[model samples]
Target: MIDICEESLKLQEQLVAWRRELHRCPEVGLETPLTAAFISKKLTDLQIEHQTNVGGSGIVGIIRGGKKGQTIALRADMDALAIREDTGLSFASQNGNMHACGHDAHAAMLLGAAGILCTRRDQLRGNIKLIFQSGEEGPGGAKPMIEEGVLEDPCVDSVMGLHIGNQFHEVKNGQVGLHYGNVMACLDSFKIKITGRGCHGAMPNMGVDPIVIAAQVITALQTLVSREIVPTSPAVVTVGIVNGGVAYNIIPDEVVLIGTARALEQGVRDQLAGRIENLVAGIAQGMRGGYEFSYTYGYPPLVNNEEFTKGFKKTAEKIVGAKNVIEIAKPTMGGEDMAYYLEKVPGTFFFLGSGNPEKNADYPHHNARFDIDEDVLWKGTALLAQGAIDWLENNGGPA
Candidate 1:
C-alpha cells in the first residue's frame, strides 16, 4: 500500500485548482483544443510521456512501471455539454459552453492520478495508460481511439474508469456505486421523415396528411417496448424532437421525427432498429404517405465484466470504506461512450456520487446548474490509482 489515500489528500488543492480552471473555460465535442492542450501541459509538468490529437482532440499518456508486469488503462472523458453555465460558482465557464456533466472533475481527477502514479513508477507492477478523451458528448471519441489502437502498443490487460455525479438517486454522497453487469443501456438513435401532400387544415381528406400519419407513428413507436418486448427487460424509446409545419393553418409537406432508443441486451437492441423501420414503413405506406427511415447504432450497452467488477469493488473498498462502496440494484437507461472502451477490453465503469443538498450539487446531469461536491475529488484519484496498482499486481504476470 503506497498511501494513495494520503497522496490523494495532499493533492486535493491541486485537484480543486485543476478542476476549477478547466471548468472556467469549457470546450465541446471533438474539437477540444484548449482542453487537450491543458491536459498535455499537465502531463508534461508531471514529466510523463504522451501523444496528442488521438481520436479527435484526445490525448494518451503512458506510465511504464519499474518491473515486468501487465498493462492497465484508466480513462477520463474531457468534453462538455452545449448547455450554458448557470452554476454560480466563481470559476464557472464564461464561454458559451459548460461542463454540465462533471467532465472537468473527471479530467482533473485522472490528472491527479497521473501525477501520483508517475511518482511511484519504480514501486512495482506494469504500465498504466492515462486516456484523456474528447467528444464523449456527441460523435464518440472512444471508437476512433480504439480504431487508432489506443488499446495496443503495450496492450492493456484490464481497464478502469469512473463517473462523478448524482445521476443515480440511490447512490449517496461520497459513495462508490458498482454494478456487476449491464451497467448502462446502448445509445441508439433513429430518424423518420414522412412525406405527404400539403393541404389546408380544414380538408385533410383532400391530401395525404402527414400530421395524422406522424401522430400514429409516434404513438405506435412507444408500444414497441410496452407490447412487443419482454415485460421484464429494460428498454426505452423516446421521441426527443419532432419537426414539421411552419404555418398554423396548412399541413406540412413532411414531418421529421427523431428519437433515441435504449436497450440493455444485444438481442433486444438488434431487434429495435429493424422493428422501428418496419413499423414506420408499414404505417406510412398504408396511410398513403412516403417515409425515409434511418437507424444509427450508437454506443453499445455498458456491460461490466463481473470478475473485473469484483476486483474493482475491493479496490474501491480499500480506498474508501466498504460501507462507502454501494452496489447498484439495477442498471440505468442512460448511455455512455465509456461503453465503447469496455466493449473492446475487459473493464468496469463505476459511478461516484457527488451529490449533496448542503452544497446544492444535486442538480441533474446536463442541467445548466449542475455541479459536483469538491470534497470527494481526491477519493476518485485514489480509486483510479489504487485500482490500476491492484489489478496490475494481481494480473501483472510473473513479476
Candidate 2:
C-alpha cells in the first residue's frame, strides 16, 4: 500500500534472475537441498530470521516488524516434477526435473516479497513467515513441516498460499482467484489384483481368466461414479494402469489394476472406495477369480477457511485492483498438498494467473511445453507481500 508498486517493479528484474537460476536446477520432492540452500542464503542476506531442514528440505523465513502486532504466513512450494524439459529456452531445466507446476515462480516471488518486507520493516505491523515447502508433488511435505512446528513458536494467526492457473481468461493479468470452500479434490490411490488359474489360450473353459475378470471389474468401477454416486456431487474413479499377461499362447494367472479416486466430498471419497472394494470382490468371486483391492488416501480436499478467505479477498482487491480479483465458481478435481496445512490451521489457498497468449505461456500445467509469463512474476511477488502486510495489520495479533 505504501507505493510498494514501484518496489515491485524494481524487484521484477531480481525475480527473473532468481526464477531462471531455479529453473535451470529443478529438484523433485523432498530432495530440494539446492533449492532450500538458495532460499536460506537469500533470506540470510536480507537479515531475515529463518529455520531450515523443516519437514525435509522445507524452510521457514520469519521477518519481525518494528511493532508488535499479528503473525501472518505466506507460503510457496519448492518441489519440481519428474518431467523432462522441452521448452527449448536457454534457462530451461538442466536436470531431469521441471517446474511444470510453476513452483519456481512461487519461490522467486516469495524471495522478492522478502526483499520488499525487509526494506520496509518499519512499516510492518507484525511478523511474516515465508514457508518454502518441498514435496508438493506427492508424499506430502506440508504435514511434516507442520509436525516440525512450522506453525508454532510464533503461532501463526492466519496463512495464505497461491497457485498458478492457465484457465479462465476473464481473470487474467495475474488476478487472484479464490473459492470459498472445497477448492480441490481429495485423492486416493488404489490397486486391485485378481488371481486365477493359468491355462492354454487355445483352450476354452479349462481355467479362470484373470484378464477377463479384470476387464469386468474395470467396467463395474466406472459405474460407481456415473450410476451409484450422486450426480450433483463430483467424483472420479479411473483405472489408469493395468498389468497382466505374459504371452499370447498362455492365459495369465493374475492381473493387477492401478488407479485413483478423486472427490470433493469426504463421504463421496469413502463411498467410492468402499464400493470399489466390494464390487471388485463380488465380481471376482462370481467369476471364479479371487481379487484383492488396496487403497491409500492421499491429500484431503482443500477447504478454504472462510474467515481467512474474507481477509484474502479484501487484500487481493487492494493489491491487484478490485477488477482483477475473481471468485471461481467450480472447484478443480486436482489436489494440492497445501490441504495438509489448511487441515492444521485456518488458511486460504488461491490461484494466480500465469497465462499470457501473447507470450505463448498458455499451456496447462505438467505439459512439456509449459512456461510462465515471466512478466507476471513481479505482480505475484507484490501480491504476496501486500497480502501478508494487510492480514497482519488488520488482524492485529497472533491470537
Candidate 3:
C-alpha cells in the first residue's frame, strides 16, 4: 500500500543483472554452493540478518520491523536442472547445469523484495522471512527446511511464494494467476516387482510368466483413476518405467515396474498407495505370481488457504492492475515441494507469467531454451513485497 511500484520498477536493471548473473552459472539440486554464496553475499550487502547452510544449501533471511506485529515469509527456489543451456543469449550458461525452470528469476525477484523491505524495515507493522531454497527439482528442499524450523523462532503467521513461467495457460505475459484451493498435485511414487519361475524360451507352461503379470498390472493401474476415483476429482496414475528380461526369446523370472501417482485431495492421495498395492497383489496372486511393492509419499497437494489467497489477491490487484490478476481455471498435475510449507502454515503460492513469444521466452519450464520476460521482474518484486506487507498489516502478533 506504500506505492512501492515505482521503486520496484526502477530496480528493473538491477533485477536483470542479478538474474543474468545467477543464470550464467547454474547449479543443480541441493549441491548449489555457488548459488547459495551469491545469495548470502547479496543479503549481507543489504544488511539483512540471515542464516546459510539451512536445509542443505538453503538460506533464511529475517527482516524485523520496528512495530510489534505478525510475521510472514516469502520463499524462492534456487535449484536448477541438470541440462546444458541452449539459449543464444550472452548470459547462457556454459556449465553443465541450467536454471531452465526460472529459479534464477525467482531468486532475483526475492532479492529485489529484500532490498525494498530492508530500507523500510523500521516502519513496517510486521516481520518478513525470505527463504532461498535449493533442490526443488529433486529430493526436495522445502521439507528439510521445515524440519530445520524455517517457519519457527519468529513463528510465521502466513507464507507465500511464486513460480515464473508458462505453467498455467490461462495467465498471459505480465499477469498473475492463482487458484483458491488445490493448484498442484502430490509428488508420490511407487514401485512394483513381480517374481516367477524362469524357463526356456520355447516352454509355455513350464514357467510362470512374470511379464504377462506385469502387463496386466500396468493396464489395471490406469483404471484406478478412471473407475475407482470419482470422475469429478482429478487424478493420474502413470507407469513411466518398466524393466524386465533383456532377451526376447526367454520368459524372465522377474519383472519390475515403477510409476508415479498424483491427486488433488488428501483422502484420494492417502488411498493411492494402499489401493495400488491391493490391486497389484490381487492381480499377481490371481496370475499365480509373487510380488514386492513399495510406495513413497513425496510432497503433499499444494493447496492455497482461501482467506489468505483472497487477501493476497487484493494486494496483487493493487500492485498489478485488477485486469492483470486472474484466477487459474484448473489445477496442474505437476507437483511442487512448496506444498509442504503450505500444509503446515496458512499461505498461498502464485504464478508470475513470464511467457512472451516476442522475446522468445515462451519455452516451457525445464527446457534448455527456457527464459523469462525481463520486463515483468519488477512486478514480481512488488507483488511479493506488497503481499507480505499487507498480510502483516492485517494480522498482528509474533512468536
Candidate 3 regions off by >4 Å? Answer: 397-399
Return whichever of 2 and 3 wins on lDDT: 3
Backbone clash count for every predicted candidate, in the order shown: 0, 0, 2
In candidate 3, what are the lDDT values of residues 241-267, reduced to their tens digit? Answer: 999996878989999999999999989
Reference-based lDDT, residue 341, model 1: 82
Model 2 agreement with the true structure over 1-399: per-residue lDDT tens digits: 457667888888899999999988999988799999999999999999899999999999888888888778889998999999998988998778899988999999989998898887887888888899999997789889998999887888778888875755555757879889897999789999999999999983899999999999999999999999999999988999999999988998999999999999899999987899999989999999998779999999989999889888887887788888899888889889888778877879988888887777988889877899898888888888888878778877443
Native-to-model Cα distance after best TM-score fit, residue 350 in candidate 2, in Å: 1.2
Give the candidates in order of TM-score, highest first: 1, 3, 2
Best of the candidates, lDDT: 3
Which model is ahead, 2 or 3, in terms of TM-score?
Answer: 3
TM-score list, all predictions: 0.98, 0.96, 0.97
Ranking by lDDT: 3, 1, 2
lDDT of 1 by residue, 345-369 (tens): 8989999999998998999999999
